[model samples]
Target: MKIALDAMGGDFAPQAAVDGAVLAAQQLAGKARIVLIGQEDAVRPLLEKHGAAAAELELVPASQIIEMGEHPAKAYQQKQDSSIAVGYRMLHTGEVEAFCSAGNTGAMLVGAMFSVKPVPGVMRPAIANFVPKLHGGLGILLDVGANAECKPEMLEQFGELGSLYAQYVLGIDKPKVGLMNLGEEEGKGTSITQAAHQLLKVNPHIHFIGNIEGRDLFNDKADVIVCDGYTGNVMLKMAESIYDIMADKKMQDPFFDKFNYEAVGGSPILGINDNAIIGHGVSTPLAICNMLLQGYQMAHSGISDQIKNTFKS
Candidate 1:
């Protein structure tokens, strides 16, 4: 398998991208290859400086760069030669099995929607983040910043999407799906959650559990949590802040350490035609390394194909 990396997309740019590629090359040796996309002059030297042999990595030249602050649609259209745009072109044409970037999240989302498109039966594609459970395990949470305003049907679809991800990628069998709500009762949340609960309860594709409260996020009550993008995004940021605050206090608990974003590398854009992993803008070398590995895992595991089949039926 071949995974493409946007060498100029992140704050650290070519240096961190190159270093991470080298680390991933050593770890994924003989199993997969890393393709770096950026200005050749800037990327090649970094590869050499990082002691990555030419045989280990392939460089794709891109002339321009889409800055982090640029508009997603405009930058993608105007800068066709930018690293992010070129990376999407490669993914569209099947030049690589997966594409990863820590660059503009909006551009990545736009590119995935227009370039590769969504699965046939999927109403809307969802983005998912891994929730670190308290019992030394992980749960899947969906629609975390994509489609902030969702209908009840969209939330129902997210349950199926999250369930497939938990099953295929995380190796969870018969993952229990739960809707995030203020209370655990049947009619707890707003009109949307109440309607979504009815839809989820009747869906055969997912093992629908009752509503899961905020305190249950860290426990093993549910393996897949579905919520609107607005709520899910807030929950994700709040969880992230816990880690930041703990780190500031110099706390070193094993459970809290799992909250670090670097451990998961990046979150994959699920329900798309191909693998498109999005990393944090401030991703470090370790984070980028994990991002590349996650991209490779997504491709090799054939999660996209499995999702497509499920949706088609």
Candidate 2:
């Protein structure tokens, strides 16, 4: 298998990306290879700096770049030769098994929609993030920033998508799916959550644990938390802020340390037909390495096929 990375996508650009890819290449030496898509002039030099360690990695030239602040749809359409665009084309053509990028979150999401597209039954692809469980593992949170406002059916699909990811990629068995709401009762939130709760309850694909409050986020209550992108994004940012505060104050714990974004590397765009991940703009070499490893795991676990099979039925 092959994993592709946008060497020009992040704040640190080719240096961090090249360093990360080299690390991932070493770890995935026998299993898979790394493919870097970016401007040859900028990326090739970095790869050369690593000597023989980066020799095995392939570089695909891309002359343009989609800036972080540019409009996602417009930039993606106009910058066809950009690193992100080229990476998506490679993924769509089966030239690579997975594509990962730390630059332009909106561009990554847009590429997922227009390039490889979403699974047939999916209403909209969701950006799913990892949540550290206080007990011992990680949980999945969907619509982290994909669709700010989602229909009831879309929320229902997020549940199914997150559940499948947990089962296949995270190695969770019969993952408990929960709707993120103001309360745990059957009647809670607005019309959207109520309707979604009803749909999830009757849906045979997931193990719906009903509504979950924000307080239950780090608990073992649910392995998959489903919500509209607005709510999920707010919560995610809040969690990150708390981690930053703790870090600044020199307070640390095993569970609290898990809140660092570097630990998870990037968020996976679920419901897309192909494997793609969007990483934080400030990702370090370690974070980039972990993101590529995650891309590999997503492709290898066959999560996309599992989702297609589930929704097809």
Candidate 3:
């Protein structure tokens, strides 16, 4: 499998990305190839500094970079030769199987939508994050920030998207889908959730398990939690803060440590026609390595093709 990395996407830029590529190259040797996209002058020296031969990985030259603070849509349009844009071009043209970036989240989303586009029948592409379960397993949460306002049909589709991701990527069998709401009882949330509940409950494709409250996020009650982007993003940030607070207090626990974003590396933009992984802007070398590995996993698992087939039927 071939995976492309935006070497100039993160705050740390070419250094962190190059080092991470070297790490991934060492571990993924003979399994997959890593392609670094960025200005050749900036990326090549860093590869050598990290004791990685230029021949070990493919280098694709991109003359520009999309800054973290730049407008997502505008930057992507103006900077045609930017690393993010180039990576997406490679992905759309099938030059690479997957593309990942820790750069501007908005730019990544824009490229995903405009480049390879969404799978047919998918209402809106959803971004999924992994939630650590108490029983040493991981749960999937969708619409983590993709769509703040969603219709009932969108939520229903999220259930199917999240279910397929859980089954194919996370190796879960018959994953239970849950709607995030104020109460576990029916008709507890707003008009949207109530309507969404009806749709999901009747959908033959999903194993709907009623509603799941905020407190049940880390428990084993549900394997896939579907919510509007507004609520899901807030929950994801709160979960991230738990790890930050623990690290500040010098607390150490295996379960709590699992909350670190570095462990999961990045979140995949599900329901898109191609594989696109988005990482934190402040991703470190380890996080970058993990992000590349996650992209490779997504491409190798053929989850995108599976979703397309499911939507077609």
Candidate 4:
């Protein structure tokens, strides 16, 4: 497995990326191939500082970096030499099996959509997060800030994608899926939510569990939850903040330790033709290593192949 690392993409840049790559290399040993993409001069010393075998890793030079505030489309167009672009380019060409980055997520998303593009018949890609529940279960949320606005069809597709992910990745067979809504009642949401709910009920591919309110997210009533980008993103941020506050209070909660967003590594960008996982900017060496492993898992999961066969245009 050839894993590409955007060495200059995160807040800590080359140091953290190199450290994470080194950690992953140490853990996997000869099991995986890691390619670091960035300014070689700067990245090499970091690897050397850690006493890592430089020859065991490949170096791909990138001439520039993309900042968080930059527009992804504009940056990709203007800065062709950016590390994020170069990393995705390699993934698109199949030189690397997966690309991992903690850089500007918007740019990464844009480059991925325009470069490798989404699978045929995939209307739009969604970001999926693994949320840990109290009773030792994982709750998967889809379309988390990947698309601010979604159609009825998009929501239905998210349900399908989220279900497949829960089954294969989370090891949940026939996982119960619920739509995020204002209330548990059938007609509690806007026209779009109502239509999506009606459509999801008949979706043969998903085990729809009716509507789930935000308050019920922690109750472990559903394994996989579906919502538009707007609602999903807001919920994720709010949940994260609450978790942080609890942690700051020094509560001895194992659930909080296990379910932390950063602790889980990264969110997989589903529906893209290539394997791409985005980590938080503040991700540490451990997070990066885990994200690398996730990229490899998703790359070889066969979920993409199943999606292609099922949704061929």
**Cand. 4 Cα-lDDT:** 0.85
Candidates 3 and 4 compared: the better one by TM-score is 3
- Tens-digit lDDT track for model 3 on 1-313? 8999999989898888988888877777888899999999999888877553556788999999999999999999999999999999999999999999999999999999999899999989999999999998899999999999999999999999999999988899999999999999998999999999999999999899999999999999899999999999999999899899999999999999999998988999999999999998888889999999989889989999999999998
The 0-to-1 C-alpha lDDT of every candidate, in the order given, reads 0.91, 0.95, 0.93, 0.85
Error of 2 at 145 (Å): 0.9
Off by over 4 Å in 2: none
List the RMSD of every prediction in angstroms: 1.0, 0.7, 1.0, 1.6
Separate clash counts for every candidate = 0, 0, 0, 0
Best by lDDT: 2
Off by over 4 Å in 1: 52-54
Pick the winner on lDDT between candidates 2 and 3: 2
Ranking by lDDT: 2, 3, 1, 4
Weakest lDDT window of 10 consecutive positions for candidate 4: 47-56
| Residue 107 error, candidate 3, Å | 0.4
